[model samples]
Target: MTLLSSCTRAARISAAVIALLACGSVLLQIGLNLLGGEPLAEALWRMSRFFTILTNLIIAATFAVVAGGRSVAPRWLLAMTAAIAGVGIVYHALLSHLLVQVGAEIIANHGVHTVVPILSVIWFAMFAPVDGLRWRDTWTVVIWPVLYCVYILARGSVTGMYPYPFIDANTLSPVQMAINIAGLTLFFLALGLLLVGMLRLRGRKSAN
Candidate 1:
């Protein structure tokens, strides 16, 4: 096979592996939660509140599509990369020390927060298309995080549960919560713009 075609095939294989890792990790976590006596519905609901779970699921879906040889929008890929990157960064930087895990939980945690995020970003940098990315596309990356903040805050207002401590409404004041959300939003935007900038630079080098 030609080199380009061979690379494409290899990329598809890598995508499939990443997809399986993400899906399996998420499923394992859910199973563990159920085994730990969390009601199935409640476990699912609580898991959904976590940005790690949601972002991993998004990564799984996006890679699954690529593995199936389907095209993904460049902007969507950019958003996914940024979101997953944030998942890894925020986990390691802010949350890693707050929790203790063993066995399957350790596997699940690393899969979503470490392994998958690193692999996804590498995959994007190496294989994903970015031919038409724009500065405005960076804004799209924050949409998911913004909506998540709104949803979690709204639900926390009634349920008194939060997935992450930083934005926990019960402990944090209104202004503090807003500040946390804004900071996270800016972080996501910065990641997106950074990815776009790298891609632009790569394109320039290719043209030279």
Candidate 2:
């Protein structure tokens, strides 16, 4: 088999393994939380609050990249996945340190935030279908992050809980929260464009 095909197989298998690990970590945390007397619904809701969890789900779906052999996965989906992974990495590096975790929480936190993101970027480097990406689809990448911000903000407004400090509407003024959100939105847009450019450039080099 060609090197490209081998990398494709490797990426698929790696993605599946990472996905299973992520799911297992999440389940372990949930089980632990319940055993500690946390209410079932609240435990689930808290799990969903982390961008880490959502990004890992996107990484899981990327196994679809390998489903049809040489056929490419949807470009928009790949873009969103890469963007979220980027965001997750940034969160883990800079923000997650503010919170404390122990035992299973530590394992679950790193599994989804660190391990999954590293594996995803490696998969993109080794096997992502760059040829299927288009510059025009750059705007599509922000959709998921935008929706997530909205959902979290609205939920936090009602529940008096915010996942991240920067976007905490309860503490920050509207203008400050908007500024933070806008900054993050811009970050997502720039990251998406960067990924598109990198992939397109790699595609050109591969063609030659």
Top TM-score model: 1
- Weakest ten-residue segment in model 1 by summed lDDT: 1-10
lDDT of 2 at 17: 77
Cα lDDT tens digits for candidate 1, 108-174: 8899999999998898777755466877779989999998898888888888899899998888988
TM accuracy, model 1: 0.92
* Model 2 alpha-carbon drift over 4 Å, by segment: 1-7, 64-72
For every model shown, what is its TM-score relative to the native structure?
A: 0.92, 0.84
Clashes of 2: 0
What is the C-alpha RMSD, rounded to one decimal, of candidate 1?
Answer: 3.3
For candidate 2, the 10 contiguous residues with the lowest summed lDDT are: 64-73
In model 1, where do residues sit more than 4 Å from their true spots?
1-7
